[model samples]
Structure formats: C-alpha cells, structure tokens
Target chain A: MRKLKRYGPPILLISPSLFLIGLFVYVLIFSSAQTSMTDIYTNPQFAGTRPHTFVWFTNFIDLLKDGDFQHSLKNLLLYTLVFITGAMFFGFLWAWLLDKRARFEGVFRSVFLFPMAVSSVAAGVVWRWLLNSNVGDRATGLNRLFQMVGLDFLENKWTNNISFGIVAVAIPAIWQMSGYIMALFLAGFRGIPTELREAARVDGANEFKLYRYVIFPQLSPVALSALIILGHMSLKVFDLIMAITGAKFYPTKVPAVDMYNLMTEGNFANAAAVGIILLLVVLVLIVPYLIHTARGDKR
Target chain B: MAVDTSITQRSGDTGRIVGKRFDWGRPVRFIILLFFLIVVLIPVYVLLVTSFKGIGDAQAVRAWDLPQVWTLENWKSAWQGTPGLPAVAPALARTALMVVPAAIISSFLGSMNGFVLARWRFPYSNIVFTLLLFGMFIPYQAVMVPLYRLVLSMQTTLHLGVGIPSLIVLHVIYGIPITTLIFRNYYESVPQELIEASRVDGAGMLRTYAWVVLPISIPSFVVVLIWQFTSAWNDYLFAVYFGGNAASQAPVTVTLNTIAQGSMLANYGAAMAGALLASLPTLIVYIFLGKYFVGGLMSGSVKG
Candidate 1:
C-alpha cells in the first residue's frame, strides 16, 4: 500500500498518454509490419473468396524489381537533394541578411515567415497555377512574368520535364519551408554571445574571416538540426506533390505518393511494404539525431 | 576601403548607426532584401489577384494581370460550391469541430504527462521519454494502414463514428509527442525548490501540481494551443484518408483539393478563392499569435 501510494499518482497521470501512444503508434507499427508480410485484397471480386496468406518477403522483392517503384525512389533522391540544398541556402541567406538589422526588419521577417503558416495543400494549389507549363503566346505564371521582363530563357516546363521535373516540385517545397529554416538559423545566430564576436574583432580578425572562422563553426549544430528536419520532411512529402502533380503523375511521384496510389488501388501488401521502406529511410536519418539531442539534454 | 569596412563593423556593433555614414553596402543589402520580398509575395499576389478576377480574366496567360473585372462570384461559388462539388463552409465548420477538441485535450494531457516526467522521477523514465519522443518523428504512412483498419473496426464494434470524433482522437494521439516535448521542456525550467516548498506544506503530488504548476502553465499552453491548432487545421493526409471523400465528411483541406481539381479546374478564380478560404483560419491564428507560434516551433526543434 505504501509503495503504491508513493508511485501511484505520477503513474496514473502519465498512463493515459502512454496507453494512447502505445496503442496508436507502437501497436499500429507492429500491425503494419505484420500486414506487410501478408496479402490482403479489398476488391469486391476477391472479398470472402480469397484467403489471406503470409507471403513472406515477396512484396518487398516485387517492389524492389518494380519499374514504378524504382522511378519513385529516383525521384525521391532528386527531390531530397534539391529541396534540402535550396531550403538551406535560402534560409541561411535570409537569416544572415536579417542578422544585419536592416530597415523594416519586422515587416521583412513577417513576409518571409508567413508562408510557414499556410498548408502545403494550399500552397501547392497556388503554385500549380503559377507553374503553368504552357509557353509562347500562351505563357502564364512565372513564365508570363519572365516573358514580360525579357527573361524568356528563364521560362520552361516546370513539373513537366520528365527527367528533372522533381526539381521544379522542390521549388514550392523550398518556398514553403525555407522560412522555417530561416527561423532556426536565426535563433542559432542569436544564441552566440556578442562577446565572442568582439573578441574576434579585438584580435584583428577581419569581418569576413571572423564570420568564416568563428561564427560559422558555432552554427554547425543548427545546420545539422535543420538538415535532419528537412531531410525527414522531404522523405515523407505527399500533399504538396499530390496537389501539384497529382498522385498518378509519374514525373514527380515520390514513395509517399506511390504508397497512397497503391493503397487506394487495394494493393495493401505492396503499400505496406512501401510504407515500411519510407519508415526505415526516415529512421536512418532521424534516429542518430534523436539520440544526440537526448544526450545533450542530460548535459 | 578600410574606412568602409570600419563603418560596417561599427554598425554591426551599435546596430543603430543608420544614416550616419553613406555606406555603399546598405543599398545593395536593401536591394537584395527587396528582391526576395518580391519573390516571396509573387504567389500570394497571384492568389489574391486571381481570386478576385472574373473567369475570363483568370486564365493562365493572364495570371499576373490585375482583374479586368472584379467580382465576388468566385468567392460565392466557392463558399456555396457548384453542383458536383460541395461547399467548403461546412467542411470549415467540421474542421473547427475537430481542431478545437484535439488541441485542448492534447494540451491538457501533455501538461499532466509533462509534469510527471519532468518533476516526478522513476526508474527508466528517460528511456520512456525517449521512446515517446520517437513517435513524433515517424512518418504517419507507416501506421496509416493499421490505423485506418483500427478506426474502421471501432466504427463497427464500438459504434464510434469515423468522422470528426475519430479525427479528434487521432490528432490527440499523434499530437502527444510534440505536446509532451514542449511541456516537459517548459516544466523543467520551473524551480524545483517551489515544488519542495509545496511538499513541505503537506501537499501530495497531485495537490502540488494542481495548485502550484498548473497556475504557471499559461505561456506553454498558448504555445502548444497555437501549434496544435495550426497543425490539425492544416492536416491533409489524415483528413483525406480518415475523413474520406464524402461531401458531408471531408474537411476544408480535402474539399479545397476536390474543388481545385474537379470541374473547377478550368475555373481558376474559384480554385484560388477556395484555396484562400481553406487557409484563412490558420493564417489568422498565425498573424495574431505569431510570436507564440515561433516560440513553439523553436522549442520543439531546439532543446531548452
């Protein structure tokens, strides 16, 4: 009774959250793993007639050999590369500029940050209109703007070029998220003490050298944090690409979109396999970062 | 060159030396900032401009032009919807119904869990906390299949409808890791001596938390509330799968997608209006409570 009383309240307080998370997150993941190994058909023709059987790794093997899956993986690789680099570059640029305390700082900051509030679906809808692929006399969106400004060479088929169309899709992703990365980088810039910069200046380190040698090194952790966050988000990107190119559009299709297509088509085993692959890729990017942050908290 | 560098360095130090020196770099910086500002506003300009345009003027070629004829017809049609597509007004209402309860319940549950984990120590609590935090980072796709089946089963066996109520429960569950992380970090900063003093006053853990910790939780509540509100409001993945495509069941995001891609595809004005309408709620929250939103975002990303 004494022991129960001593530990009871805290356990009771945390149990509801623990129970829900366990049921929804852990239990469901295990269930998904199980489903990935078995075949289930939701089609009316197969309903009640087909017996669900464990197919072992057949689904995974099939996905590995599938042309569509290969294309999606390739698209994912290209999208992740472009999205991370573009977001980071623009994020760092805006943060560095704002760090100088320019005029109308509040207005500029709000302008950059406002995109973070809009849903990717909403942004994608607007971008789809803005990236209209029609050219020449029917030029539209950025293309029309380019034509007006005599920068016609800048206009091309955005999200329509088969080989590198995912690059154009990454542009909207960058626009939506670079502001968030800016906020992260801005916080990091502020966290460094003023005394350090003054000390570097006192030692005759020029402005450029001071930043290159002292300031940039201090921001490595922030850069790492932003990279991991952006990396995982790009891996799981769905709605943005979905709204822009639709799920069936092969040029911009990533694994998440492919999984949605498969799931909708009643290919449950294959969908689960794709989902597990996504989860594994995300874990590869996120697990070490989580462990690092957790250890930092102890210090 | 040396004089110019000195002025720049001094401005960096004082941060208020404007107009004291005619620095050449200042104009260049302003030009760069202005260029990016335009880049950021271009799509928004397109959205607003096209939203107000007549159907004839809202074509792809005329995307950058001012509305040749301004009209409220598109807004009306979007709100009231066409024959094939359903109105977004009801979906907006459904989203509100779903987002509010999800935000409130998750925040309160997060507070309690945070209090226990931050202050009340036990064996392997760190491990438990680490395990809970991992759930926040996993792609929902991994669990989407099982979760969908589970909800379906609940609808049949438990008579729990798979509409806003199911969405509320799902959001609250997925929201746990983020909310708990925010609150745990918040409560960690609460001085332990205060808790000890309350304990010396003969109050038990529950009483101490209720009287002591709960009162100081308003700031964290604001942050978590705004974060949860926006995330739940902006969600499309869950809204699509769990909410389904039924006109009565879908949320604003799903409805907006349907409107944008359906017969309204040719009607750019209606599509833009629908997009703006769907984003309005979260945008309003962000405009009004942006500081707390940023605070919540940074807190989630960076440890206190």
Candidate 2:
C-alpha cells in the first residue's frame, strides 16, 4: 500500500499509454506465439510439430530457395547503400549551403523540407504517375520523357525493371529525405563556433582541407546519429514501395514489404521469423550507438 | 558541437559582429544557390508542366511549356469525382485527428517522464526508462508481429475498441522514444533550483509539473509538437495497415494511395493535384512556424 501510494499518481496518469503499449507489444506477441507448432499452410489443424512434422529448419531453408526473398535482400542492400549515401551527401550539402548568412535562408530551407511533409505513399503516388509509360495520356513520367527524346534505349518500366527499379524508387526516397538531412547538417553547422573555421584559414588551410581536418571530425557524433536514423528509415521503408509498385513487384522489394506480404497471406510464422531477423539487424547497428550516447559524456 | 570555423574573420574583439564585413562569398553564394535550385526543381517542373498540359501536349516532343493554357478541368473533375465528397478534405481531417492529440499528449507526457528520469534518482527509474528506451532501436517490424497479435488479442480478450485506438497507441509508442529523448536532454539543461524552490513550498507532483515544468518548456514543447505532427501526419505504414476498411478513418497518405490505385488517364495532373493538396497542411504550418522547426530539429538531433 505504501509503495502504491508513492506510485499511484504517475501510474494512473500514464496507465492509458502503458495499457495501450502493452496491447500492441506484449499481447500481440502472445497471440502470434501459436505458430511455433502448427503447420500454417497445408494442415491447418493444430496437429502440432509431432510425428509427421520433424523439420525444424525447413521453413527457413525453403525461404532461402525462394528467388523473391533473395532479390529482396539484394534490393535492400543496394537501396540502403545508395539511399543513405545520397541522402547524407545532399542533406549535408544543402545544410552547408544554407549555413551562409543570407537573405533567403529561411525560404530555401522551407522549400527543401516541404517534400518531407508529404507522406511517402503520397510522394510515391505522384512519382508513380510521373513515371508511367502508357500512350493513353502519354503518362509523361521520366521514362516517358526519355522515350520521347529517343532516349528509349534508356527507358524501361523503371519501377518494374529488376536492375534499375531500386534506383527509381530511391529517387523519391532521396527527394523526400534530402531536406531532413539538410536540417540535421544545418544543426551541426550551427553547432560549429564561427572562430574555428576562421582559425583554420589563418593556419593556411583551404576550404577542402579545412573541412576535412577540422569541421568533419567535430561533427562525428551528429553525423553518426544521422546515419543511424537514416539507416533505420531506409531499411524499414514501405509506403513508397507499396505506392510505386503495390506490394508484389519484383525489382524493388524490401524486407518490410516482404513481411507485409507474408502477414497478409496469413503466413504469420514465417513473418515472425522474418521480423525477428530484421530486428536483429537493426539492433546490431543501434545498440552500440545508444551505448556511446548514454555514457553521460558529450563533446 | 561547434562547427563554425570562420576564425579568419573573428579578429576584432570590440567592433566586429560575426562577419559583418561583406565577404565576397555573399553574392557568389546566391548565384551558387540558383544552380542548386535548378537541380531540385527539374522533377517538380516536369510534374508541373505535365499537370497543366492536355494529352497531346503531355506527349509532345518538347515537354516543357509555360502554363499559358490554364484549365480547371482536372481539378473540377477530381473535386467532383466522388459525388459531393472529395479526397483531400476528409484525409486532412483524419490526419489532423491523429496529429494534434498525438502531438499534445506525447509531448506533455514525454516532458514529464523526461523530467522525472533526469531529475530524480529513484532506484528502479532507469530500468523502467530503459525498457521504454528499448523501443528506440527495435525496429517496429521486429516487435510488430508480436504487437499485431497483441492488439487483435486485446480486441478479443480484453474487449478493447480496436483500429484507430490501436494505431494511435502504436504511434504514441514511436513518439515516446523521440519525444522523451528530446525532453530528457532539454530538462537536464534546465536548472535544478527552480524545482527545488517549488518543492520547498507545499507544491505536490501535479502542481510542480504544471506550474514549474510546463511553462519553462515552451520551446521544447513546440519542438516535439512539430516533430510528432509530421511523423504522424506523414505516416504511411501504420495508417495503411492498422486503419481498417473504413475510408473515413484513413489519413491523407492512405487516401492518396487509394486515388492513385484507381484508373486515371490524367495520371500527371491527378497525381500533382493529389500530392499538392495532401502536402498543403504541413507546408502552411511550416511557412508560419519555420524558426521553431529549425531550432527543434537541431536541439532534437543533439539529444539523439
């Protein structure tokens, strides 16, 4: 009772949020636990992984044999590489550009960030239409433009093309994101004291060398944080893929879409397995970063 | 965190503001900026021209055209497409319902939780706090399988109302990691004496939180509010799935997807119209709230 007295108010105040979280996190996990035994596909009955079912690793084995799963892995790896590198480079560059004391800094900053405000699904919708190649209304997307200019050699169903579709999907990803990267970079830039760069110049350093030696090192923590954030965002990306190609397209598949497909088809066991693996990958990147930040230390 | 390396111009102690003298880089900077704008505007310009063009003009060899021939036909049809109901308005309303409450409650609770964690030294505090922090790195996908079953089970066993509540709850979970991180840092920077002074009086927990913490946290509050608004308003994954069959419950993201899903030959025009209309709320808010957004992202970046 005494313990309850001290905690009553906070518990009562936050119980709604806690209960809400518990329903989503704990209870849902509990429900999906039935998949450990039953054959989700053929048998339907709770026959269990008994006399007939001795294959512990077969589902995972079968998953690897599937070409779509393999392609999705390749797509995620390539997309994460291009998407993060591009988003960071441009995000930083835009931030750097806006760092100058200028009359139109605010206007330009807002202009860049405006894309981020639109949902990825919506952005995908617009971009998908822009990329369509139908002769009906000419569908004047990028692919269409290339075709008209006799750059038809360069054109294909870009979103459906296994080799180039990732890039096409990533184009909008970068567009929606470059502003966010710009914002983070601007923050890091502002964090820089004015005297440091001037001092670098006094030491006879050029802009390139100065940034390489002085400014870049100081911004490491923020840069790392940004990378982690973008890494997670890129890996977990869904809406754009769904919008541009719906769920089942070949070329641009990622793990989130794969998981969504499995779950939608009611293959909860395999979906759980996939979700667990994806979680592990995200954790591998995130855990160390949190440890670094939580050491009660700052630059 | 200081990145300002412009020490060459910082020589004068008494008279010079930080680069008050016109560096030659200023006008050059604007010209440089124009080049950047063109790169950014290429797709936007293409989308714009194609939106205004008729079918033949859309398919034209030279696609670029000034909007000389103005026509309200696509807009009229789209607005009139589904009887009296239009896509953009209802989506906006649904988006607002999600954004506003999520922003307010998340920020408010976030600041409180942050304050308690940062200031007090109760034994089990960090453990509880860390459990919440567990959600920070665990991609929602990992826990989502368990979580999805959890929500559905609640609908059955616990008799909880589902759908929007379940989704809003999930969003709140997402919001906590970020919002708490922001407030934790912000409150740490806040002076301890202010709380001590209030406690010396007869102020209890609720009063101290209301009277002391909330007023001083206006800036941090604004920061979290904008962050929550964007993440919630722009959410695609949660809305598409957690929101069920009712079109009314769907936010702009889902609605936009539905519009694009159907048959429309005027792909360019409809897409531009849908995209433009969907993004309007955030753009309008941004125009009014520009300064706070920058300050918020910077401060939040440091917290992370």
Candidate 3:
C-alpha cells in the first residue's frame, strides 16, 4: 500500500493519456489490419457489429486488380513527386535569396509564411476560383491573365485535365506548404555559419560552386525532413482534394478520399485495405527516418 | 542556368558596392522573388475580391479586376446561410466550443506527461516516447473505420449524444501525441535543477506541477494551443464523419465545404466568403502569434 501510494499519482497522471493513445492509435491500428483481412462487405448480416470472416490477403490481391485503386496509387505518386519537388525548388530559391539579407526581409518572410496559416480547405477554394477554366468574359484569374498576355495557348483546364489533374490538385498543396519548406530551408541556411561561407570564398569558389559543394550538401537533412513530411501528407491527402474537387471527382481521387468513400458506402473491408495501404506507405517513408532520428537523439 | 552564367562570373566580391557581382544579383533576385510574390498573391487576391462582390459581379468582373460594385451581400448570405447552406456563425461557435476545451485539456495533459517524460527517468521511457510519437504519423485513414466505430459505440455506451463533446473527446484523444511531443521537447529545455529544488522543498509530482511547472508553461501552452486549435478547427475528416450529420454539431470547415460543393448551382461569391470566414481564426492566430507558430514548426521539425 505504501509503495502503491508512492507511484500511484504518477501512474494516474500518465495513464489517461497513455491509455487513450494506446486504444485509439495502437490498438485501433491492429484492429484496422485485422479488419482488412475479413469479408465484412460480402454479407452485412454476418458483419453485424464486428467483422467475423477472416479472408487473409485476398483484399490486398483485389486492391492490385482494382483499377480505381491503381489509379489512386498512380495519382498519389505523381502528386507526391511534383508537390515535393516544386515546394523544395521554390522554397530553396526563396530561402537562398533571403539569406542575402535583402531589404524588407521581415515583410517578405511574413508574406511567404502567411500561407501556412491558411487552411487547406480555404486554399482549395481560393485556388479553385483562381484556376477557373471558363473562357472569354467568364474566364477569371490565371486564364484571364494568359489571354491578356497573348499567351492564350498557355491556358488550359487547370484541375479539370485528366492528364494533369493531379498536378492541378498539387498546386494548392504546393502553395500552402512551400512557405513552410522555405522556413525550414531558411533555418538550415542560417545555421550554416559565416565561417563556412568565408572559407569557401577563400578557396576562390564562386556562388554556384559554393552552394553546390557547401550549402546544398549541408541542407540534405532539411531536404530529407521536408521530403518525409510532404511525402506523408501527399499519401494521406483528403480534404484539399475533396474541398477543391468534391468527393466524387474520379479524376483527382487519392487513397484517403477513396477510403472515405469506401467506408461511407459500406465497403468496410475495402476501406480497411485502403487504410492499411496508406499506413504501409507512411511506414515505408517514416520508419527508417524515425530510427535514424531516434539514434541521433540518443547521441 | 542562363542567368547563372551572367551572374557567376564576377561572384567572388562580397561588398555592397554597386555594379559588383554580388550587387548585380540583388536586383535579379528581387525581380524573381517579386514574380513569385505575384504568384503567391493571385489566389489570396481572388479570394478577397470575389468574396465581397455580388454574385453577378463575381461572374462578370475579371478576376484580376477590382470589384466595380463591392457589396456585403455575399458576406450576409454566407453569414445567415441560404436554404441548403448552414450558417457560418453557429458552426464557428460549435467549433470554438469543442476546440477550446479540447485544446486546453490536451495541452494541460500534455504538459504533465511531458514533465514526467522529460524530468522523471524510468526504464523503457525512451521506448514509450517512441511509441507515443508513432501516434503522430498514423494517417487518419489507417484508423478511420475502427475509430468511427469506436466513437459511435462510445456514444451509445456512455449515453452521450452525437455532438461537440464527443468530438472534443476525439480531438483530445488523437491530439495527445503531437501535444505530448511538443510539450516534451519544450520541457526538455527547462532546467532540471528547478524540479530538483522543488522536490527538495518537499513538493510531490502533482504539487510541483501545479506550483512550479505550471507558471513556466505559458509559452509552450500558447504553442500547443495554436497548433491544436488550428488543426481541430480545420479538421474536415472527423467533422464530416462524426459531427457532420447535424447542423448544430458541424464545424465551420465542414459547413463551408458543404456550402461550397454540395449545392447544384455553385455560388462562387458565397463560397469564397465562407472560405474566408473559415480561415479567419487560424489566420488571426498566425498574424498575432506568428513567432510562436514558426517556433513551434522549427522545434517540431528538429525534434521529430
């Protein structure tokens, strides 16, 4: 009883949080994996309150053959590639420019960083308006600008084009996140001491060579961190796509939206499959990185 | 690469003199950044201009043009909501009710958890921290079906209605990992001597938390509050799946999305207005406490 009292308050204080996380996060993850193996959707009566039939890896096999699933996977890949690259490119560019100690740096920084504050839903809506594809007088935003500048050939259905649909979806994501990536790269740049720069200059290295050999290499971790963050986000993208393109837009569908649709439509097993696939992808990106960071933290 | 040739030739100079290699790149950098600045502003400009325009003006006015006749009609319609659209005011209130309590409770719990994790040493504590951090990255999709069933079952079992309180519990539950992560990292920066001194003075864990740690936690509280509030307020997946079945329970983001997308005839004006309204809370938080927000992001990235 005395020993119990000594440890009881700490246990009480920590248990609620730990218990909640264990139930909602860890256990639920296992349950979701279990759910993906069952044939819950084949017969609703058998499903009742819980999925009973364990179909094993059949759902994964089905997902491989499912065209929509394959398309969502492909779309996710395209979106992740373009989104990460674009954000990093422009982010690094902006950070490098600002690292030069430009005038009104604070104002520029705020403007660049402001988009991080905007919700993805709002970003979707705003970009949807800005990229409206209507021609002539009804044409607005980017399309109108193209026409005015005698670049009518440059105008196209932004998010509506099937070939580039995911790219269009990626635009708002890139916008909302580029500033954040810039902040990361900016911090990375600032952390690179002036001594490093002066030493590189003393070696008669010009700007390009200096950055190529010195600054860029040092920023690999920041880039990798950005990649991990952006990669996970793209894999689980739902709201921005749904908010921008609506839930039923097949062309722009990704796994997160597909899973939502599946679950809402009573395809419990399939939704669980999609969910597991997303988790696998996140694990692929994050697990190794987590181990690496954990090791770093220990050192 | 073209600009690189022109600029890299005389780049060895580091002085501020005009016509130097460094100085020449400055204007070019400014111009390039200025171009991107325009790109950045395009959507925000459209959102602001289109939200105030009357429906006809929204359609007829060139997107880049200033509204010929700025009207309050869109804001009015968005505020009160049309027949199909839910009002923004009530939804915002609902969001605040859930978000405020959840954010506060989670931050407090997170602080205590962080205190124990950082200051108090125990076996497998690092492993425990790792397990908790994994919670942060489990894409909500992975747990959606079970989570939904869990929430629904809890509602029935606890005799609680499908409303904001249930939503609060959901946010608080899922919010634990990130909040804990932020607080743990933040508290790690707090000197260990303070806690040792408090303990030497005969304060127990809970008492030390209340008297010593609580007072010093305000800045971290702000960081966690803004992070959780923005995430909770902006959350659509949870809102749509759980609270979205009813008007009184739906968050502003869900209502705004429904209004924007659910209608047969799209009202760009009102939709833009609703979007702005939904964005205001986070935007205000960002503008006011942007330092903390940036600080949170940096620390979050570095630690994670």
Query: TM-score for each prediction?
Result: 0.96, 0.85, 0.93
Give native contacts recovered, as a fraction, per prediction.
0.68, 0.41, 0.64
Better candidate by DockQ, 1 or 2: 1
CAPRI quality level assigned to candidate 1 from its DockQ score: medium
| Model 2 lDDT tens row, A1-299 | 86665566655554554555565555544444335223454223222333233345566656768887888878888889989989998888778767866558876777787677667876776677656645423435665566656676665666767676787788888988888888887878788876776676667787678889988998887788789888988878888898888887877888789888887876666776667667667878878876777674434
Candidate 1 regions off by >4 Å?
A43-49, B1-20, B58-61
lDDT of 1 by residue, B48-108 (tens): 9888998678455666889898899889888998898778888899999999999999999
In terms of docking quality, model 2 is: acceptable
Off by over 4 Å in 3: A1-9, A42-52, A136-138, B1-22, B58-61, B263-266
lDDT (C-alpha, whole model) for all candidates: 0.86, 0.69, 0.82
Q: Which structure among the candidates has the greatest TM-score?
A: 1
What does candidate 3's lDDT look like per residue over A1-299, in tens digits?
Answer: 96566566776788888888899998999989988998877436223855367899999999979988888898899999999998888888899787776678887888898888887777877777766767776777688888888888877788787767889888888888889899999999888876777777778787689779988899999999988888877888888998888888888888888887888788888898899999998999999999999999988
Q: How closely does chain A match the true chain A in each prediction, as TM-score?
A: 0.96, 0.83, 0.92
Residue runs of model 2 more than 4 Å from their true location after superposition: A1-23, A26-38, A42-57, A133-139, A143-157, A201-209, A297-299, B1-7, B10-28, B46-63, B66-69, B83-86, B156-163, B264-266
Ranking by lDDT: 1, 3, 2
TM-score: the better of candidates 1 and 3: 1
Best by lDDT: 1
